[model samples]
Target: MTASASESGNTVAAVDLGSNSFHMVVARLQGGELRVVDRIKTMVRLGEGVDARGRLDPAVRERALEALDRFGQRLRGLPRGSVRVVGTNTLRVMRDAQGFQAAAESALGHGVEVVSGVEEARLIYLGVAHSLGDDGQRRLVVDIGGGSTELIVGEGVMPLHMDSLEMGCVRLARQCFPKGRYTPRALDRAALRVAQELEPVARRYHNAHWAQAVGASGTVRAVQAVLKGLDLSPDAITLDGLLRLRECLTRAGRESSLDLPGLDADRRPVFAGGVMVLLGVFQGLGIQRMVASDGALREGVLHDLLGRMASRDVRDQAITAMMARYHVDAEQANRVSGTARHLFGQVRRAWGLDDEAEAWLRWAAETHEIGLDIAHGSYHRHGEYLARHSDLSGFSSQDQAVLAALIRCHRRKISRKALDAVPDNRRLRVERLIPLLRLATVLHRSRLDDALPAVALRRRDDRLDLRFPAGWLEAHPLTRADLAEESTALKRLGLALRVR
Candidate 1:
């Protein structure tokens, strides 16, 4: 979709392929202000079909495809870079998302990015922050979607802490009330499950308390609507309203027979389950009131895109943070990052790489030696663990996974089993970059004051040739030993690494 530079000139669209609902926002920018021209939402509940093995069922795919077709038609006139499409929790779970993403991109006439959960939380907070009119006070924002729940607290436009939990409306509904019956026992179980999931974050969230509570996404909207419909309050949801909603649901029992004017028909099926989870949230955290906001992931995406266009990419910050946290030698990191980037630039086009890969290489170089903190014995594994589990503030879940995998495989055996950890869609790209990282890491092993010898990179099928100055390896025996070991590892991955 083409985003017009002018409100009358052209339009930019943001499509949120959420687990519970697929949402699209068509808007035009006028004097740096966004005037929303069109908004579309359809409850697709993509999470409903995700099984234990993390596969998206055929039925869910069909529904999502059909919905995207409609959204695509609406986006036909938007400019190429004007439209941003993102998939949330369910998309993250899909092991075979390549096919789904390709089809969705074709239907929408735009690229679809399946972002990580932390990224999802970040966007949710941005949307909430913007919708709240730049409130200076730090506030907690909660977004409970069909497949995941995002909690974020931030002051102004920046989120200080963000977390995306696995619990969500659709997943909870399927797990707790598969028959679509809202029995008291079922409701209680669902609420308890949510409570259990929140336990990890509850104390910290409560202690790092916000002055106000802001809710986002369909569940929050539904709760606010029901409260208003009952003439309780239009401003925020109350404990009494929650209790009333739960009682009403328990009385109704069957989803089909339930009648609630405030709830939409598409939302009705999972409404009771979502309410149970929210009610648990209220009780678990001693929350008395919360104001729902219309802004969410989509708004966050637009704001982030703007930030990127303005050259303030958060991923850059993330790289810096990782380097500092891992206590990396700044000068050496810069040297490696520079060299890796140089090699990446030379081969990116030939290898079908892009900016994202470039960023990945930079980040991997920054933290490649993090394992040195632990015993240097297999520091690569230590680095991998740190990258994988560290509360990397700015990175999405997918980004972390990729970075961690690169760190893990940067050294050692380069086994096919190591690459198996990452998703199949990303495996090939990681494999292509691993040899370059290894070669760069080996060249920088000395970390000396003298200028390094010039190096050239050549690729032949799966093999790579690193031709250094004549006799450079002979002059540096330690470098020679490292290269000798690295060559053995590369050989296992069906690639030959030669050093001159």
Candidate 2:
């Protein structure tokens, strides 16, 4: 669901749950143009608490919730789907992530989505590109976060290549600058680690690929500021200034002693780590200088959300591409899609579905047979795997789970485990959705476009009565057997499928 300017909410807010800080941006869309209204950021150092078991420490968890409590209050009165809260790095790799996500959503009064690292690079590019507003120069955008760093090279607003590396401020600082102490040896070791991280992808993002270099997010901006404070390359980050800053840090010998212009107290602990990454990036990518941008993940999310509100959803394009890639039978997919939509109209209200459900049905109908390219036997499972694991731009992890579940249970015995994979709140609606998709596929098993008689569907709680034209079932024995088999499958999901 996307927010629209036509709706009561001309105001849209994007909240970025970063490992280092929680940032929120509220913008108003008026006459198709976005205007910034409010922005707030709070440092939480969430990555610091991730243990070997992948759990957030209890104290860190409490601190995170407290920060979310404040963010949620600011988002008060915003309509659902208008406020987008995205989690990066920490949330993506955390153990029991679903549990934390649910609690976070409760506090924020909005759904929270964790994007893949590659997707994170894409969003960061979206934000930086929009801020720059397409100068026609190919640019390399770099964003260093607490637990990860993203490098994106793009022309105008479209990113051509992207990479997200494991090196980040918090993780690296903990490794190389513990107790806020940075020695010459420690800095060199950190530089080496950053090099190894970039070794494979550095060439692809080197100077030859992009005409200009731009940095986004907190760490990069801080580095740009510190260079000016020291009066060493006051305009942008030059390699010489970065090296000078490294020397300054080694001379201080401790985070407490290091003092420079534009270095905030909160940043001191992780400052050395961020600088080391910048140094390695410069050396590895042959960068002479780099400037900073006001845009980052939060802004990118706003623009992406705006695109969604305007109905330019990237997920639609992703589904279309998947269909072509997997060699789906276009005609058969069309038949199933049409029937599913038809069935949906009858049961939507009764089953508590909305526009989002319609979208799920359409996508499921179009891509249901994708697994046929892999093999006919258990094609449903193959389709599920594709939906579950593929990097479908703009589809959240929860969104993928829902799509996967629908495809998995479209035929044969419904996979209870597949349905269970869907988030708790939306599980029931997906269960109801499965039977409708199954019915569509069952009706079109012959894969002929000869057109069947109009079928009417009525729903009463968990029971769905599917009525065909008079004598239609008797005339089509094969479809009847298909429905009989479907009835058994529906029983497992606690749904009744009565065909008369």
Candidate 3:
């Protein structure tokens, strides 16, 4: 679910369950500016031992749960809509994320959103752009995490291109130097390997492409500290600084004996791996100087939540754009949205539906016919695909999945199997919303410029009765026919629809 906007926007929080660390920032909104009130972070290294088969190790899971429990305690008494939680690359790779996400969300006060790689890059760019001055330079922002690397090219508040690659400090450390030993040959091999991985990404990020390069995340901060210690450059990382740092570190040959100033002990094991990744980035992209950006994905999530609280909801705009692109009739969509919301209000409590579930149904109703431009047949399927894959700006990946499923089930034989395939928590929600969508479609089948009759809802053991005004259904023959057809549609879901 996106988020319920609070009319009196007071406070907002964002929790980033990152691969290398977990962070929570709570802030108060005053005079349209965010004032930081509280901040917390822990070096969980959550991506530490996720294997090729997408299983999180037992130790890693325990660490993540303990950290989330602590965060949960801190989030006590916060309003429901005030906090937004997001999971980064590690959650993206976890095959069984339900157990962990459920536990985490229980500790926190809201559901956890595991976004796509591109979405992560987009948020990182947003945080960077908001933090920095309006220098008007097209910047290349890099965030190397525990399991993924995000590269974004943008200027001002907009991003032109964004990509997330499978390269990071924790993953690299495990693959290259599992014993925490620093050797010239080992470092050389790691850097070359990272460079090789970048071969596909380097061509697109050539020097001519972006004016300035900015680094984000802990890996970059450690590199900056090592460079500042060497008296090389306090503001930006240079190629010479990297080469010199590698030489000095190689002399020590082990993490324990490294004599670099400002190197935190917690960062020791992954420091060598981070440096090698940086060296590869410099060599592959010809980057001479790179500065660190304090802002990252977590802050961007907060800003996005704030936008929703205001009236400028991006999901609404995205729906309008999708309808326009697919040539869905605006009048019909409005009609459906009206009926869907009316029906939702009628049975929300009976069906165990919440505000978030209601909002999703409304969104689906407004854009269900979005694939008619492709072809009328299987348009629902096409629309589902578009909703699933499109770069929907305001929606998290989970939001997209729910919206797409609602659309897919709107006209088809009620796909109980498909509903089962979704996350368990959402299966019942989809089941409940599909009936509302189907009924709304039936009410608006005439597609006429006329208002629908006031309807009431009543629930039986396993069936629903959609009662229209006493004589309204009898007077409208076409609506009667539509209801008859709807009966067949509802029957497929083991549900019976009665028209009164």
Can you give the TM-score per candidate against the true fold? 0.86, 0.96, 0.90
For candidate 3, write residues 248-341 as lDDT tens digits. 7689898788878878888887888788888888888889989999888888888878877775666787788888877888899989988898
Q: Any runs in candidate 3 off by more than 4 Å, and if so which?
A: 1-9, 183-185, 254-257, 324-329, 348-355, 446-462, 469-478, 491-495
Best by lDDT: 2
What lDDT score goes with residue 376 in model 3?
91
Question: Given candidate 3, what's the lDDT at residue 47?
Answer: 82
Worst 10 residues of 2 by lDDT: 1-10
Judged by whole-model lDDT over C-alpha atoms, candidate 3 comes out at 0.83
**Which candidate model has the greater TM-score, 1 or 3?**
3
Residues 272-305, model 1: lDDT tens digits: 8788778877776667888899898898777776
Could you give me the TM-score of model 3 versus the true structure? 0.90
Clashing pairs in 3: none
Model 2, 1-500: lDDT tens digits are 32334543589999999989999998988888889978889999999889767988989888988988888888877887788888889998899889989999988888999888888899999999999898889999999999999999998888889888998999899888877788888888999999999999999999998899999999998998888888888789999998998899989999889888899999988989999998999999999999999989999999999898889988898899999999998889999999999999998888789998898889998999888889999999999999999878888788889999999889999898998899998888888788888998988988887887989999987788998989899999999999999888889988788889
**TM-score of candidate 1 versus the correct structure, residues matched by position:** 0.86
